[model samples]
Target chain A: MATASKAAADSRANLPFVYRQYSAEQLREVLHKMYLIRRFEEGAEESYMRGLIHGTMHLSIGQEASAMGICMPLAEDDQITSTHRGHGHCIAKGAEVKRMFAEFFGKTTGYCKGRGGSMHIADVAKGNLGANGIVGGGIPIAVGAALSSKMMKTGKVVVSFFGDGANNEGAFHEALNMAAVWKLPVIFVCENNGYGMSTSTARSTAVKNIADRAAAYSMPGVIVNGNIFSEVAEASHKAVERARNGEGPTLIESKTYRHRGHSKSDRNRYRTKEEIEDWMSNRDPITLFESELREFGFIDDRGIEAIREAVAKEIADGIEFAKASPSPDVSETGNYVYTEQA
Target chain B: MDAMVRELSYAQAIQEAMAIAMDMDERVFLMGEDIGVYGGAFQVTGDLVDRYGADRVLDTPISELGGAGVAVGAAVTGMRPIFEFQFSDFATLAMEQIVNQAAKMRFMLGGEVSVPVVMRFPAGSGTGAAAQHSQSLEAWLGHVPGLKVIQPATPYDAKGMLLAAVADPDPVMIFEHKLLYKAKGPVPEGYYTVPIGKADIRREGRDLTIVATSIMVQKALDAAATLEAEGIDVEVVDLRTIRPMDKQTVIDSVKKTSRLMCVYEAVKTLGIGAEVSAMIAESEAFDYLDAPIVRLGGAETPIPYNPELEKATVPQVPDIIAAARDLVKGVR
Candidate 1:
């Protein structure tokens, strides 16, 4: 008798179905997060090229929207396991840009206290399990975390992020089977950028869509256009809800592209420059999202300009924060080897 | 609440320690291959499944990499997980998780989180599991900085050390000797912890310090008993916790005895005995030593299935007796 339904009733921003009914403000926040990731990566690359950032880094310049869309549905307590090209994932998962930059600069105030550098960045309080250096390394860990949730009856889910190359690893099959059998609450998100380093997915992976392999494990398999912000959100929403309701795991393959070479060492010899340009010009996640926002009258030119300036300032502040932070003391290097403090 | 002390087998001791840990902490759970229903490969986890239920005593698929990774992940989050490898040799499959993820997460994450995970490995050469199954690879894990490698020799140490390992805030690798599972000793009931990174002197002597590991501790003590008739008092130090290598205990014993003999079941090259020998050489014990440091380790080859070859490969009671007799009689 009482119609207290408030699913989409608490919104004022006139945004359409691209985000499954996310209001204009929520859409703007998504765009903001994506911009932060994009600029953070550019800042990192610039520092690396200038010899300010130590060690090599893998940049996810083009795969920004996939990070935002997938993590958008997750709650604050939800967890994610990221890959080597993890800067975008970290930012989209809500990690502070300053600490991330500090980590890359090898400062004591960094995420890993200057020990992990780029590949092993983590924020535990934010429920990020940690980014892995090994391919397919975090799949089982995600499954395990999901198992802990199920065992404790906590009703929390975990999203595991990996590249296309990791699907070829033995851990992929093993982890999927275990998660399937137990019906653990985990989402295996594959960002298939068509390449695992230099080799294309065509050469390494025999399957057409990485999600199709999910059928073997008796789970839902869906593929989405990774560049489109709303499509990624729509695709992952069903899986996240199903996992939360205790259905099982889902394998969602978001088809995206990387604008830059795999790592700083990549020569871009695997794919042509023209092909890279084609993907960049047409399928850029930020550009398409901005165009969609204009079409829907959710945001205007001034809004777009203000958001860009703010992101640029935030990234510059992160760089300055990293540059000013000091290196860890040599004597303190041995302190964290064990949890025991004597 | 039972305070009465009773004899428990090495496997029983380890099982009791795990049971005590799980009962004490709700966050603790066990995961491994066929461990829940099949009672594990060696039956060390025989009755844990029935007692803890499937949720806590989980039976995992035959995927060491996945199981190990899951354990590391769970530990990194909040749970205290005890993962069992059917054979220590299978740890090769889990090298990435154990060495890379579990061991390094804390240091790599700047100590924001600690991997309170325990890995139980049924190791050593006595069972004739051969090269694929029965290799004593303690040295390989000990070489790593973040791992705490412990080879529990007796029933008491097995239970106490396992409880201690589960309580530890870091990854502890428990190398439970396959041969010592059935070996029995007096162990007290209820909660207790044998502090890790410390060695226990099983027997005290004045003539020589025979630093031994795992089952070799019992062998060294037996050898010492036989040498007692020959008027040779041998101090047998059970190097239970291998990674930390309690230098003070070994050094102090060597200083008192003025002679040392290092013995273990692993390969002589880069074995636990090498660390003991090097410790004496580096410490003030070197000046007090009456003779060159002697080490009795496994032969540099795969453990043979042949009974005689297996016995020949690892130092047994008789071998320790011979080594002790010779070392005490000024034999190089």
Candidate 2:
């Protein structure tokens, strides 16, 4: 009996942080969310190719694990500010895919009522303050939200997600410094995908790692393998705890890669095709997370297939919902410019 | 707006309004550089830190862009933040957050959010601060649709309009002239609000309409008094709000007087005067013009460091009087 108890303790210690903490059902949901983010981007790309959606979209096809992991430790009321490449963030923050697709379709039934397209998608009810189009624009805004949380005694934490390129922006430094000085409950997550548009981090960034800059603000700089869901989730858990305990902000650098170009207009000239193929084949986040789930016995082949089938159905339904939604009237273009006076 | 009134400087009235706003709502707070123990660059927020403490009256680092963006973020997330730019010209540094984020947030979010933030600017040239420190850039922000820009000419309007801005559901920008901070006028005590988007007729006449904004209003009033002696009968209209301007008041005054003269402190070309001139020309008041419209505005040059040069750069009482005399006498 003593040996069996010791063996159980060893097994629990060997499991990933989330696997040890969460139930099997909860772990399966995490896998489901990861798959949902992947298929959602795939569906969006297909729709974009079919001429169903106008304007451009920043797809996060290869960065699903980063979004899911960082958001795993957050409560429903915890707030987050996203970036232009923010579809995964929006989904992870609990935005309905139907509304997201409808927004891309510019329908009145969309999340922003068709006013904001891909870049500005938001679900404020879920505490996802809209994704900003400007690089590093959401950094200070997240600090402000954290300031509100601190001042109002709301006990809520805020996360600011930006690219590695944003580390060079003045807003990032100013915001991080202020957050540290005020001891505000906020987390700064830099999803360093190695490039900002066509410029690589080595070409644009000054530091070896984006996390290294957090030392300037006197906050803990954490780096994690963003493709590995367990590793990213573990780092996010510690950061979230630090924020909630009134210890001030933490900076987490999730080193991930994006399969697609920066936008629809990227010509694929800057990086080699072989490098993209390597990340796609060896480090795909959804594939890694699924294997982990299967290894832990949290999900079987049937369960994985079932999750994929469900996600496919949801994506198809979301597209149908967006296609059927009505466009806003052109005459009402002036609406929402100001709060309509009573 | 109340029976009990006392004389207060424009700066003091603004301070009292901020205190009253803080007292009324716990969510209201002030943010700026040196607004705390240092009492601000112009002493406009003097000694409030002693009363409300540092948290409520935050003294941010000299980070205009980041500070403004934080205020926008705080405002959107259910806090009423009143941000003060030490100098109006510094707004150039923070225009991205002001114009892109604060002004466009509500519209871009499909009316899901309202940024109830207030920004104060100490504007205009005088006191020999040179070109960088002294500039009337209200027109730059006034050009945005989602922003409400106001230039209160008196202590009463300064206090009342600030309270109104705090209570407003949208972002409101207040441009206070540094020279006007020491200027005193009657101010009522307690809670009161001067309605925004309305013009005040400072003086009435029948010969010509002198439409003015900010410190230019007082200059126009002084000029009107001088023109009265010369049988000009000049009417002075204080254009309190720049964006969503009170066009009907200016139009009626021009139609009644049959002549128009615009006076402003910004550069003469493409300033408030141009907008007022174009507005009248496009309105029913166009046919009422007995003479060519005149714009008494700043000279087409940067505000220089020399006292005399600074005096010449912006419109003065003498300049307004001369412009009004020409317009009333039908001399282009």
Candidate 3:
């Protein structure tokens, strides 16, 4: 018993978070994608403030590392179901900035033709099952996708992304349990962003980490620092590999903080500005990865500036393109009610 | 071309439809609790596991929410998943997936994709499974816009409609009454499809029109038989698909008969009958009506365990006869 326990502890202590060195171009592309999501969300907030974009927006400003890292290893056919704060997931999964901005701007050019706005944006053609409005709503749907993969022998994997608040939903438990039972190829990525709108994980979640609950479903559960791209990448790569190998699902608790409030309407009364500042100044994923790449001799200070300039121009251009896009005709309102009624 | 015809029960017919569909399409699979070895809670999926193996005929965990969620997930990923709810009453556990996810995914996603999922619910009150196990929730499912809600009244429809639902691109909810499963009818041997949203004239007459669904159709047919002896002709239109409503058939029948009666096993208030009533009331049939539209549905109460009380809630043959007499006699 002592030897067995010691082996488990040693393996747990030696988690493989070593950064996989990539080409200068590959690193630049990844950093560039992260920059795109950050600026796109900031633009959405700016548009909301200016009364150009209506309805609510859930920003994934601080959680970009987890999104890019987790989706990096996924195939184009691999599926993902993200939460309300799913702009990062959608962008990381390769959604165009123009279409995303167009969605926020309520244009027909948007992924959902201005009907879904931000919370419901999706690109099913790109294998993004959707961004759900309801918390934990996508878990079961992702599980269903995984079930299809297993039944059809499609050799595809599904990643179900939800917040810490969503971890408390019955869907989370039900989906996880079934996925485990059937050995469905699913990776449940819990973005533990501390707060579910206003309620803190400490106030609501019973476990120390969301991954601890995975044991109930008889699957491997691991915690990774979501702020560090390497950790998320390594953890997700292993999980995704497990899924592809037909070993079944894994529960990954990506412990990260949302740099912005839960949604656009929050006033920051839930926590101190000091806590938010601590995360931003100390653990911002974009800056941390930039510094890491610099240390690795991947790029210099000049390269960083060029990347930033490129992304800023892309964001401005995308926003302008979205502004030029038209709203859907009222005639299209009733077309999708059913699939042509058979 | 003459096809082989065999008299099969509703359960056998449904099983045959799934078997033929699975054979024709490798993408089709069945998922539900106890459907594999146990053959399903109501034995509607008997011996399918033996023929299709455990992979195609899956026995899910006893979590309806989880089972339904996985089925929804599978359906969207290019598989024709026929998910069975043990009873219509237990569908409350799967409302999130059925209503929010399945019915709204295509519309919410701007029609980029469609969920070709088929969910079968053994519904209506006849078995002493009481309130939790016997409820006609088709009206509830029919209210959702992006769903094709079907109620196969006869063995012929039970077979044909199930095949058609598998072919539909949108989510289709098939409500099979527990009592209808054992009722036998002539089903064709090979693959065929009954057109969805099209009503079938079970028995045609001229004096009055009876629009009935599921188990209520049989009762209405018996009532039409009794009304024949009373010197009043009746037209029986079996509404196999409820969501599409077959409004044109009912309207045309009412126009011909000049009287309308809508019957279902759900609660009388805001039921499918109400929709049938309003359809005629708002259409050209309204001008041809000799009397007000009569809707005979179950009483607005939970189905009791006692066999007599259970039978009392919904319209029996005698109750249908009495209601038909009142409507034809011009009694308000």
Candidate 4:
């Protein structure tokens, strides 16, 4: 019995951080969520093509693992401030895809009750402050939320997710400096998807890696292959633990790529088709994570097929729920501008 | 409403209100550039750091946009942050967070969040601090829908309105004039609130109604005293809150007074006076106007560094008296 226990402990030590930390059931659930994020975006894309949704959307087709891995270590009460390309983050943070679809459909049952359609969608109850439309806008807000946590002794660590583009913004520098100076519990996650709109980070940013800028703010600068679930989750786990321990913030630059353009309006003039196809076929986060799950015996072929089928059903049901939901009254346009007086 | 009143300067009144608010709620705190041991640019947050400690009385770095956004974020979560822009002109640097985020967060989030933040701005000219340091930009923020903008004139209103702003669930902008810091008035001790969006009739008369705001309220009252000997019978209406402006009070005063003259220290064109003039024109008071409406406001120029030039920029007591005399005596 002593020999068997020793062997089990050695086996766990050889496994990845996520495998060591989470149960097999939780790992399977993570895969299910990754599939949910991918399918949800694809569903939203199809809906947009059918002219059901207005306005452009920023899709995160190839960054599923990054979103799931970052959120895996966070509790339901642990807050996150996302960017415009934030559907994956919202889903990974436990937002129901049905309500997200309802918001896109401009229905009252939506998370924002049709007020914040896509860019501003939030699940406050789930601790998603909201996805900001402004680049680097949520950075300071995350610091402020961290300040609230430290001041109120709530022990809630906040994660601010931005793109490579936000690295050049003054708000990014200011927020990082303030967070570091105050030793606030927050994580600055920059998903370096190569570009901010059409501009590449090499052309826009002064630093080679966004994480390098974190040094000026006096915090740990971590770089990870965002396409690899284990790599991203391992980095996130350490950063989150450091934050909870009140050691201050860490900057994690999750190096990844977007399978799609910056937005629906993106003409795809900047990058080559060969590069896009390469990432799609070789470096797709969902494919990589799924293969890892299978190799580790966490999910088999049958299990993967069932998860895909379930996700497909959830997407279909979500679209139907959105279609059947009611739109807000035009007369109530002035509502929510100020708190309703009791 | 209580008889426990004492003479206090506008700055002291504001300081006392901050202490009272901190005592009442643990979430209430102050954030600014020099609000700690430096005591603030205008010495408004004097030594509160000693009592509340640096944790609550935070001295933020000179990052206006980021600091303002932080306050908004804290407010939305649970903390009641009172962010002070060292100078009102610095508000230009932080307009994105104040206008786009704090003012629109609640509406954009579909009421899922309310930014209960209070931002204090020491506004108006006369400090000889040049164009950048001195500006009456209350009208700029007052234009926003979700924000409640107030300009308290006296010590009593400063303390009361500040406490009211702290209690308000929405974002409240207090535009305290720089010149009024030394101005003294009777202030009641302890916690009290002066309801926002309500105007105070400083002095009542029958001939001409002077609608004033901030420092202009006191100037108008002084002009009323001077005109009393001249038999002008001027009524001074301190239009305290700018956004959900006390339109009823202005219209009623106009209906009784038969003449209206808007007095504000902001630029004469498109300032608070324009809104007051337009409101009266659209109201029932339009028929009661015995003479053309006059606007006594700041000159159409940036506040210069010279003391005399700065005085010339905004309306003075003599300017109010002249404007009032002309309106009451049937002269444009």
Candidate 5:
């Protein structure tokens, strides 16, 4: 009877999820990053509306927490593969925002010299593989990166970010199965922002939750509050640690909502205005983080105002840099087609 | 002053060149489905795994897409990987990796990366491999902007072209005819790199210029020999590389001969012959031509498994001889 009671007590003790405490400095840094991403995207939207941007852009307006939280645990050597909505991921992963802005502006000073435009910005130095336009394209690529890490014994992990809609892709299943069989050090993070384009998750996927799909691959699957930066950060930390320790890949479902339409061209007819207003007002990640930080005595009204002003200035500087950069030389069209031997 | 020339088959020459390259460079590795232990489906890479060991001579699963992706990734990351497709027909499975990623990566990335990868395919009909494994699809790859396409006809060109392909910085696709591997010619020993995008005059004559690729080169040479007996001396030009095609050499040969006949094993519709014919017609060589350019190619149809049917699907030696004879005679 005494042993049974002791076991029951231990089970109860492990029931509540333990969260990692953040200091004032850490909280401020997270807020600053979120504000920067928000401002950058907002500026991009204005530019697009003004006919400055040419190509299709999928902005990560409301999914700031997932990018910042996941990237917070990654080192400079760790790699990540992103989806089309990759501006936030790139920013959080420490890419120069000015270069990213220049990329969107189609300037030679952009990350890819304007060749990649909005969909394919990659910075190898920052360990960002690149953003992919093809659905589920980056899953297997991340697996390859993780395999390279294992083979080279670099102890580096790769994180692959995809949308909820990508779960239906054959590559998703194949990549996850391969990663599982080989115990690849990768993290499969699904940003389930309710819809994959105009198609809702309920209509496309049979399973209620994307996390449940992990059982097929026999890996650890967890659902987290994506709008809450602390929750996302803590969950990502555990997953990254597990992968680094050779425990194989993990599937994380970040249940969140995108405040904007899927892309710049979306009419928002699939969902109601009421749904958008509710998510924006009640489930806003930035607002939630601000309230939490204020409660923890980490920030006040003046600090928030200063952060907003600084972000505004950063956006303005990025635009100026992009406008001043030169276009790529047309004569060098055949350059770099192949690597020349020295 | 010339040494005695010996005859060799295309397969033997490719095998010899691969063996030599492996001996010369430690970084060069070959991988394909059943290429290692099976010696390749057509035996082009005979006993390579045993000689170079498994790490360098890898046998992969039958996943062309996955295998090509790995090769491209490895090539970009500092390893020189040579991939073999058991048959050229299977390349469709890897078009995404080849066309989209390998061909566009360096350009899209601002020239920061290089795909120094070589893919070899046993192309054309002759084998009773049916429609699934006996088509010549080099024209499809040549149409892409960044890829280098090479089709070597003679054993000597095979050896030299492969060496050049290994040395080149870009991704090169070498389409080897299944029937030509057993054909023979004299091959030099040791490290020799033939310049890519250069045409070679196999037979120098004045009556007409017969441009050919892969197996058609032998046929063109045979036709040239036959035409000489008929008092019509014909020049045969072997276009080793199709993409960065040797337009100058081809035009020079046409200007000298005044008549042109482009031949290939691929379908006549938009084949390498079409590109060569168009180039000749557009160049200064057009004014010197005594006869209109003629292109002889495979009929547009699936290569049937029946031996006779398969042989009929592609351009044969007799077909080239007849075509060259007609061109020399100014026949429509």
Candidate 6:
């Protein structure tokens, strides 16, 4: 017990003062969320290839830290609005993985009751507001949520997650300006994953750093190493702390990369294989966390194997649950069209 | 024996209705650009900020999208927000928030939440505001699902329809004609909620059924009276709510009148009139029609800054009268 306590304290002390140390069980929960997102995306890709899933699927393959890092600092009641690439954020915010899978499968057991596909899953019970398909759409919504929190005196914060493409949208500027003026409790996380669909951010945006835009709004802007889980976690923790302390919103530009194409159909015409291989081999967040834990003597090879096996089993169980869930009734298509109760 | 109540302008009726609703429900609040201190662009929200504090009657910045988004979020979280657009033309700026977010959230969320927000815009022409500030875009919103569109033409209907919009569980877009704000009529003094998705018969006759909306409703009634002098009895119908429209009322009126004419301030092509004409043609009343469904709407050209050109753009009283006369006489 003393050894485990000392290891946990050391891990906590190593992190920035903004982060709260987790017990072994809490650490397992965070790991479970990350693994669920990874497994869910893998399954979705397989299903898409097999023609079981229609429309586009924006996989959060190599950008798990951007989700888990930001979510770890939020309270259960804090709200979050996500972008089209949103499965990781939803999983991190405590949405049921099985239900999310069912949603992708268009089953009635889905979070949106099969009405919303992968890009628009919402679980209001879990404070996961919803995912938006439009670029920069969720920014204003998150600010509105923060306004609601302040008006209702809930002491809750809202996190708006979007890609680099959203930074150019007009709503992004308007939302940030309003949030700053009102000093709303919100966090704007820009997952600058190199590319927005086929276009690279370098060619699209004139500014090298998206975080620098926050200076115009008078908000604290920070850049984090999105591939390094600990660094990403440290940045998010500080931002969330500032929000919770009523110090207004923070803008975090997480520098990361996506292993997969923007959607299922792209053929990697833009980037070189060497670049992809370098990030996959050197900056993989899961592998880095595992190696750090092992070096700290927190777990041995057997324990690591056990963790992998548990994650695999959990994912397998979620897939089975999703497969068994029934599809939504076609006659009920117009059921939720309006809430007028007939 | 009933006593005659005092007559009030359409703007006055709307103000009275909002005041009554605000006094009754604490959750109800008014918000818009220039609504507070400025008393609204049309002075419809006159002295509201003074009567109610700034908190309840908010003056937003020039950000229409932000104001609309805030209203939507607030509506979903249990507040009844009555958001005003300075003019219906400015509503285009907030279309993304209104059409995408507020209109679809309930359906997307599996009916878990309701957006009880009322967006009031001063629509239609005759104000000489021109182009950007003068346009009728209710048909655009009515095309979208999960939204209730209302156009109140009379003082009584304005008060009753506004109350109904405020009490509605879904988002309602109330399009008030800029020309009819000063039009005066007798209105009862009290809280009354008229049912939406229903049409009111302004004049009943057997010659023809003239379906109109917003400013055209008054024009249609005027045409009906003129046609009545010529022994051409015409029935006029006011389509208060465009979406969830009163198809039954229009069909019944058309069946009885055996002739139909749809009038609107929108363009002649693909306007609300086109939809109503199609509905009448498709319904069982098709066989009972005495003449083809005639639609009198605005010309397909931009509303020019010149007052004469602007008048030519939309259906005026004379155009409605001429259309009614021609349809009744079986002349195109």
Highest-lDDT candidate: 4
User: Per-residue CA lDDT of candidate 4, range A211-303, in tens?
Assistant: 999889999999999999889998999999999999999999999999999999899999999999999999999888888888877789999
What TM-score, to 2 decimals, does candidate 4 have?
A: 0.98
I-RMSD for candidate 6: 1.4
Against the hidden reference, what TM-scores do the models get? 0.97, 0.98, 0.96, 0.98, 0.88, 0.95
Docking class for model 2 is high
Tens digit of per-residue lDDT, candidate 6, span B175-208: 9999999999989888887889999998899998
Tens digits of per-residue lDDT for model 1, A152-239: 8888889999999999998898899999999999999999999999999989898989998999999999899999888888777788
- Model 6: which docking level applies? medium
Tens-place lDDT digits, model 2, residues B224-263: 8887888878788999999879999999999999999888
Residue A204 of model 1 has an lDDT of: 89
Q: Please report, as a residue range, the 10-residue window in candidate 2 chain B with the lowest summed lDDT.
A: B322-331
List the candidate 5 regions with Cα displacement exceeding 4 Å: A1-27, A177-183, A206-223, A242-248, A296-302, A329-342, B1-28, B45-47, B50-59, B183-191
Task: Score each candidate by Cα lDDT.
Answer: 0.89, 0.91, 0.89, 0.92, 0.83, 0.85
Q: For model 1, name the residue pairs that clash.
A: none
Each predicted complex: what DockQ? 0.77, 0.82, 0.74, 0.85, 0.37, 0.61
Looking at model 6, the pairs that clash are none
lDDT of 3 by residue, B242-293 (tens): 8887888888999999989888899999998899888888999899999988
The deviation in Å at residue B225 for candidate 1 is: 0.5
Candidate with top DockQ is 4
Which residue pairs does candidate 3 place in steric collision? A144-B73, A144-B74, A145-B73
lDDT of 1 at A57: 94
For candidate 6, the chain B TM-score comes to: 0.98
Worst 10 residues of 4 chain A by lDDT: A1-10
Off-target runs (Cα >4 Å) in candidate 3 are A1-18
Which CAPRI category fits model 3?
Answer: medium
